[model samples]
Target: MSGPVSSTPAALTAPPKSPKVAPAPPAPAAPTLRDSNNNNNNNNNNNNNVVIDGILSKLLGARQTADGSCARVQLTNRELLEVTRRAQQVFSEESMLLRVSPPLRVFGDLHGQFRDFLLLLDQTGLPPGTRFLFLGDYVDRGEQSLEVVTLLFALKVRFPTSVFLLRGNHEVQPVNRRYGFFQEVTSRYNLEIYARFGSAFAYMPVAAVVGEKIFCVHGGISPRLHNLDQIRDIPRPARVPKQGLLTDLLWADPHPAAENFTDNLERGGGVPGAFRFRPHMSRPPALYKRPRIFCRSTTTHYLLGA
Candidate 1:
C-alpha cells in the first residue's frame, strides 16, 4: 500500500522520539544554617511557653489561703531562675518610661496580696481583653510576696505588651531586703533566688504615660525631672540610686504643706524629697511649655490591701 508502509512500521517511523518523562522537580534546596537555627529557637520558645503555662495553672488553681498568708507553691529555684531570666529579657527592651494607649486599668500597690490581686483581675478581666498597668509595690507587706512576684513575672513574660509592670520602691534591693520579701525568699528558696529577683527588678520601667495625657508612677514627681527625655535616657539594668531622679520617682510622697519639695522626713530624710503640686507646674517655664500632663500616683506611705 504506501510503499509497503515504508520499511519500518508507522509506530517505529516517528523519527525515534525520546520517551515523554516529566523532569523531576528540582531537588528541594537543602536547609541552610539560618533555617536550622530558627527551627531550634522556635522549639525552645514552645518549650518555654509550656513551662510557663504549667506554672500559671499551678498558681491560679492553688487553694486560696484562708489566713491571708503565703503558702509556698513548691516551685524550685531553677524554675524561679528561668522565669526571672525571661522577665529580664523582656524588661531590658523597654525604656524607663513606657508610653501606653488607653482603655487601660491602672492598679497600684498589689503588695503581695495575691488573693486580692486575683479578685481585682477577676473583676476587671485579664490581658488582651483589658490591658493593665501595675504601678509597682508588687511585693512585700502581704504574706504572699513570693506568689505575687512569681505570678507577675509569668504574666509579664506571657503578655509582654498587654500587661506592664513599673518599678516600685519595694522592687529595689535596699528596700525589699528590709521588707518582708527578703525573709520570704530566703526562707522558701535561697539568697540567690532573691538576688535574681532583684536583678530582674532593676529592669522594670519606672513610669508610664497613658493616652499621652496622664503620667503614672508609683510615687509622685521628682524635682530633678525637667523633661520626659530624662526618663527615656535612664539606662536599663539600673538599680535605684541613693538619691536622684530615680529615687524621687520611687519614693516621693505628696505633701500639700510643702511648696515645691521637702525632705521626706518619714523615711529618714535622705533623698526623694516629697513633691507638692496644685493643678499645674506653672512656676517652671520648661514644664509649663510642655503639653498638659496630669499625674496619678500611689504615695510611698500608702500601701494597698494593707
Candidate 2:
C-alpha cells in the first residue's frame, strides 16, 4: 500500500551563518606512571597520548556549525571520546542484561517514518546499554526520510558501538530513486549530504548475524548464494549496480524447498530454482493434485508438472 511521504521545507533549509565559535582548550597531558628508573614509561605515555590525539582529531574534524539559529551541536572530539567511554562502560556492565529480557526488538522496513519512528523509540526504549538491529529500509517511501536518517545518524553518534544499521534493498540508488528516499534527501539536505549519506549507506553492512543463529537481511536468498560465507566473500561496492552480484543478493527471494531448482521458466523467473517458495503452494487444485515433479538437472533441480 502507498502512503504519504512527508517533506518539510525547514528540514532542507540551510543553516544560518553565525560568528565562529572558539575551539575548546587543549587537554592536560596524561600523567606518566613509571618505575624507579622512569626510562620506559615515556614511550608508553607517548603512545597513549598519540591515540588520544587521534581520537581528538576525528572529533574536531566532524565539528561544524550548521547555522546561527540551529542549537543542535554536531559532536566535538571531546564529546565523542566521552560518549565512547560511556558506551564502553555501559556495555561492560550490561553485556548479559539483554539475554535475560529480550532478543533486542528487531524491526523491519522503517522507510523514514520519523514520527512513528520516534514513537517506536518511546515504545521500544532507546538503545542505551542494550542492542537493537534495524533490518535496513530506513529511507524512502516516507516524508521524514531526512529526519529518519539524521535521527539514526545522531544515534550512531551517541551510542556508536551499541547501535547497528544494515543496508536494505532501498539503500541502493536506483531503487531509492524510484522509491522516495532520493527525493526526500534532495528535498531535505540538498544533493550534497544526500550523496554523502548514500556513500555512507554503501559502507553499511548488508546483513547481520544476530545472537549467532538468525540471519537478517532486507531481501531474501538467491541461487548464487549457496552459503553464508559466499555472501561474505562478495565484494560490496560503494554503490550497487542496477542488477548484479550485490543487487541479486539484496533483491533475491527465498524458497522453502530443500534444494535449488530450475524450470522452463526463464533464468529470472519467479520460481527459477528448487529453493523453497511460499507462493508455489497457492496454485490451482489440479496443479496441487499433480504437483510439479522434482528432478535434479545438471545445474539445478526442477519442479515439473505441466
Candidate 3:
C-alpha cells in the first residue's frame, strides 16, 4: 500500500505541534439544529442528521491558532451520547473486515490531534466527495480526543458509505483508560457516557482490504488468521481481547530481524501470543497473496518486506 509505508519511529508517532499564535478565523456557521429523538428509528433519522450537523459545526468550527493547537469546547453529554449511538448503529452493520475499493485516502493514527485531522480533511476534501479509510487510534495521547472522535462519528453518520473506521488498540477501554481518553471523558462527563463510547468502539471493524489487495489494520498481522473468511467470521460488539486473533490484529508488530513469531516486548511482553513476526514466516499464504499490508501503530510497526 503506497510502496511500503515507512516504519521509521517518527512517522506516526508524533502529533504535529500546533504553531503558537492568535486564533484563526472561525469556520462558517452551520444551521442551528434542534436536539430531538423518537422511538421509531426511521423517524429519528432527521433528528440524527440535525444532531450530527450541530456536533460537526461545533467541532469543525473550533478556534484555530498558531502552535498547531486549537481550542476545545466540550459537547453536551446528551449530544456526545447521541453521536456514539448513531455511530454504533452504522458500525453494527459492517463486517469485522471491510472490503473496500480504491481511489481512497487511508489515514494512520491521528492520536486525537483534531486540528491536524481537520487540516487533512481540508486538504483531501470531506466525505461523500472523497472517500476515507481511517486506521483507528482516533482517541488518546493528545488534548482533543473528544473533538477528534466526535467529528469522526458525525462524519460517519453523515456519510456512512464514504467513511470507514477500523478499530485500533487505543479504541478499547483498557488501553485508553491507562492512556488519556478515560480521564478526558470522565473529567468532563461521567462513567456511563465513557462506557457508551466504549460500547460503540466494540462494534468498530478491526481491519480492511482496500482494492482487494492492500490489507490495512491498526496493528499488524495475526497468525490465527489464514484467510479473509476467518477475519470476517470474527464476531463484533466485543472488546479487544487479551489474546487471540483480534488481539494480534490490533497489537502485533513486525520485525525485520525476526525469525518467527515472537513476544512483543514493546507492548508488555508475552501477554498476547506471537505479537511480532517476520512476514514471510508468520503470515499465512492465503492471506498474504502478494498483498501490501498497511499497519500504523504508535510504535511504528509498518510491515514492508512481505
Which prediction has the highest lDDT against the true structure?
A: 3
Candidate 3 lDDT by residue in tens digits, 1-306: 222222222201222334536534334345343222223346568756767787877776677755647878678888988999999998998899888887778888998888888776655655455678899899989988988888888878776777889998889888899889999999988998899999999999988888866778888776677777877888877766668888888888777777667778777523455388775463465466646555455544344455
Q: Which stretches of candidate 3 lie over 4 Å from their true place?
A: 1-26, 31-41, 65-68, 279-283, 288-306
The lDDT values for all models are: 0.67, 0.45, 0.74
Give per-residue CA lDDT, model 1, range 1-306, as digits (tens): 001112322111112223323321111111111111123346676677666655666665444344543345788777798899988888998888899877777787888887777656545545544567888988988888888888889877766776789988889887778778999899988999999999999999998877765677887677788888898888877866667888877877766566556777677424444444422334333234433454445632221110
Residues 144-180 of candidate 2 have per-residue lDDT tens digits of 5655655565454334444656677777776787778
lDDT of 1: 0.67
Higher TM-score: candidate 2 or 3? 3
| Candidate 1 Cα errors over 4 Å, as ranges | 1-41, 65-71, 268-295, 299-306
Q: What is model 3's C-alpha RMSD? A: 7.2
Worst lDDT 10-window in candidate 2 = 5-14
Ranking by lDDT: 3, 1, 2
Better of 1 and 3 by lDDT: 3
**CA RMSD for every model?**
21.0, 15.4, 7.2
Task: Rank candidates by TM-score, best first.
Answer: 3, 1, 2
